[model samples]
Target chain A: MACDLSPVLLSVRVALISTVLNMIMGTILAWVTENKRFPGKNLLETVIGLPLVLPPTVIGFGLLLLFGKHGPLGYFLAEFLHIRVVFTWWAAVIAAAVVSLPLMYKSAKTGFASIDKNLEQAARTLGSSETRVFFTVTLPLAAPGVIAGLLLSFTRALGEFGATLMLAGNIPGQTQTIPLAIYFASEAGDTRTAVFLVIVISFISFLITYGLNWWVDGRSSMRKGG
Target chain B: MLEVTVKKVLTDFTLEVDFTISDGILVLFGPSGAGKTTVLQSIAGLSIPDYGLIKLNNRIFFSAAQVINVPARLRRVGYVFQEYALFPHMTVKQNAMYGIKGCKDMDGRYKLSVLDVMEMLKITHLQDRYPVSLSGGEKQRVALARALMTEPDLLLLDEPLAALDDKTRRQLRGELKELQRRWQIPFIIVTHDRTELNYLADAALFLRNGKPYRVLNRNKEQPYD
Candidate 1:
């Protein structure tokens, strides 16, 4: 019998949406924290990095409280906006975004830090405005790091399973993702489907990792770009 | 004409300097830590003085009492840093044309001409090449081209030829003198090289340990203003 493909589609949708969120929110956080000096900077950095080390169940528990119909944001969202997020696809997206943000932030920060400061000063002396300099000089130089960040972020979001399972639940066509499908397929003795999904996910992971390695190797650090 | 009477306090010592220079090459001759670069930075509006006045051609660049400090971009001055400071990502042509595109023509005295500056500095052929691909002398010329393209009223060159070989250094010294004569702007060069002092300086002010020690003139009579 042909296996169900709904899990694959739902996984792709969640990963794509989460990756977009990671790009915008992660890069903005990196730029702000890297450039400015404000109070509680250390605290902010710790909070950003907390998801990297936190247990997925713990994160799910926190999300449950926050969006469980009567919780603060959940109450406001449900009452004012008529949206419920406790066990939905949007909750899966939020979980993936929160988990993958630190990687993107770290990568972008490294990219921005590797830039030679004198180049910025040179542009300034040449009469370019700060915004102009950022677009024309800063962003281009930091492209490699930013690209690396995006790739890593996308991969991390794709592999997200724990928080997603707890928050979105295995709702078949509505919220069943690849990892959840594989687990239930084997548990229910559906060996053929389980084997197929395992192979597919492993193959995709190998492709992403190999591509990332090759891309980074082609542009090693301190090698002058002409 | 430019007049500067500025005092800046550094960690090791205090910097108190006073001078008045006109349209000629004025060399700030000093040792390593004598705050020579600070003076150049102050004149270029990159550094703030503790207290004093920097007046150039009736425009107040900075004044402590009058509460004025013009930013670097609006100062109508060009600064060529010691390391040449060219945008590594940009080609020679882009670097040379950087300051003149968006900004208005500076004060209507010196025309904005990238072609003239590039042709005069002998960097016209290097328009498409990046900074890393260029040799030391080529980089220096590109830096000069970038600075001069703005047609600034004051050009600050910090150790312009210090990184070149002896032959290239000698060659650029002569070209710099020619460029200075043609530009006719106040060229304040910071250098410790005695040869540069004799060759390019129409006037020289020696600095020691963050203070203006003395002033030597080739044409003017008095030392201090």
Candidate 2:
């Protein structure tokens, strides 16, 4: 039957891993850029955001060049700990993550920027430390935006194609994710599998986006009512 | 007595404000963008100036030459932001207790109960409500109660009455004035509303384009208009 669940399962794992890593990195990046004013801050933002504008294939290629076996980073890792990233699950995860970074960063940054600065000032004046203010006030208010960004990033990672393909070749049960599965199925004239996967992915995406909209709408209404 | 002097230069305007308030209301009266709020912000340690100094009861809050800038958490100042800036996610009770620590019940400490401040602010009924669910006046009262919970040495109100309706403003202004009198804490209120200034202020400091244009004592006058 060649009932291939490899792409389905592996892709889900890759998306999950990529989403988690992206959420952490994107949050930290957004917090830094939104709050601090260091030297060349604009430059740093532009550089960090380059992944958004650059082609996904280019990003994959860049990652490959920087972290391939002969690459300095890869060589150091191999010599130190004998870990190979090329054509591995980690590579697929990183590729998807790079493609999805800007989604998280942009959304989270907007969230952080929209928060009232006066609330934090008031907290500080009332004897709350910087750490306490962030956790208690800033994080709570920023949760909705962060959650929205994370979910969007997860969805994008689920559909990541160009970067994933370029960085990690489609090895069945290894680096082959759902998108790759759909592509290979279509190429092989297995229309039933392709159509089924497409329908499943479409249904899930639809549900997620609809759920997000409902949540945001309910949140705003709840706020207004409260 | 709290004497603050700070010289801060924003991109558009330079703020060089100095004043001292021992007791009663020190109204920072100014038109919009006159840097009146900047002065209060500097006092609260929110805005740090490039030069000058701030001293509260002989303790230096900020000293450019000494390179001493006391952080806001240790300053014991109460601030009411122009919009109140209540915590939208928390209930009114949680908001009231937001900045107050529990050290008062444990050992050598001073504290006010959340219930007390809520009752004082007349927000006891709204204790379970969030900021988004609160009316403008309710939010202001909650902000006041939250700031009061810390039992601050000096209170700063940055146009606290600007967001309410005329009737609500008039009503809250009276309540705020009464509260101020009862608390007996020096207050620095930034506002251009002459009505509010006349009704609540004992002394008025007029700011024109980031400078103190004049300082008037309203104690003797029977406020009109």
Candidate 3:
């Protein structure tokens, strides 16, 4: 009875899905925010990073206001489209994406900013289109930073707790990500399962941190030595 | 043939310059901060001057009144920077072949393959090497090869030999002059060094504070030659 396999597997599945989806959105948004500075760019950056500092419950409340059953868009979706966002896997994804967005954007933006603008100018002179230059020179050069951002965002999404719990309500198999499972187990007086989840989360966090450091340091040394 | 006349007023200096080149090396000579390199940049379409005209081989590259400003890619110009600015990530071969897009030979094949120029510059063995791995002279050679491989109508070098030591600079200068003689294209060499102006220049134009002050005829009045 203590070793329930169902919820653990469900937690991993939800975490993985949320991480990958958030990473994709983070990469796209990061590239746009860093590469192109238009009117109200600062405002966009602030909005993207808002969830990082805002209370997790506040974020969940905000999402609920926008996507809950009685919420404006949520009611329309349920009535017209029959889509449920609250207490669902999709809500967990939205929560994770919101919280992890800043990590991705900051990492990618720094990476793109560090690249030499002259390289792009040279490519333009060589008859490369704007799109080609971005793909070939700019993206490759900024790749390390992008990878770093991805790892950071992935780790953040995996550990998402407050917003996930508030918005998705700790559904046993549907919305129970790793962090939520741990919280729910501890609340249910199942210290053994809670401790088990904690250890796993700790190990994952250690591995991701180590991987990011190793990658970034190795690149720096290679560049310096060369 | 390349003809250029442009003017730009910067905070510290005003750049008003004019020159022409045809099938020979033309040197822009002046002291530092003379805006000689600005003239070359303007020709390459890297920097636009306030008011002027730039025509390469009878094609107007930039004209203020006509509102014509051709981008750098369409200019078909090969610019060798003072720092070389070779792509650090690419090998010598990749750098050389960078500008050889849509090239065709007499047989309608891609003409000016990087291998030929690699051999011509004696850089065949160094093709696999990166810019960071090469010495100053070797980098200069690779940069020169890269620029010439483009088969441009005109070549612009901004103190191409300025970064090397005296011995290497002289050696490269001799090689560059000889290379110019072998190629059938207009060349513009910008440098503040009188020694380089004397050695490589077919004709020299002196710049002062972003303006052309003197046009020295190499055949008649070159002090060093």
Q: Score the docking of each candidate (DockQ).
A: 0.57, 0.60, 0.38
Q: What TM-score would you give candidate 2 relative to the actual structure?
A: 0.92
How accurate locally, in lDDT, is each candidate? 0.85, 0.85, 0.81
Candidate 2 C-alpha lDDT tens digits along B189-215: 888898988898888888877788777
The alpha-carbon deviation from the true structure for residue B46 of candidate 2, after best TM-score superposition, in angstroms, is: 0.5
How far in Å is the alpha carbon of A71 misplaced in model 1?
Answer: 3.7
lDDT of 1 by residue, A38-96 (tens): 99989999988988999877877787788787789899999999998868889888878
lDDT of 3 by residue, B84-111 (tens): 8788788989888876662322355356
Report the first chain's TM-score for all candidates: 0.93, 0.95, 0.91
Q: Taking the tens digit of each residue's C-alpha lDDT, what string does model 3 give over A1-226? A: 4565555566556666766776677767777877787999889889988988999889988998989888998999999999998988888888887888788778878878888876766665665566777877788878887888878887887788888888888777677777877877898999998888888888988998998898879888998998
CAPRI band of model 3? Answer: acceptable
Off by over 4 Å in 1: A221-226, B105-113, B219-225
lDDT value for model 2: 0.85
Model 1's TM-score against the true structure:
0.90
User: Model 3: chain B TM-score vs. truth?
Assistant: 0.92
- Candidate 2 displacement at residue B139 in angstroms: 1.8
TM-score of each: 0.90, 0.92, 0.88
Evaluation by DockQ, superior candidate among 1 and 3: 1
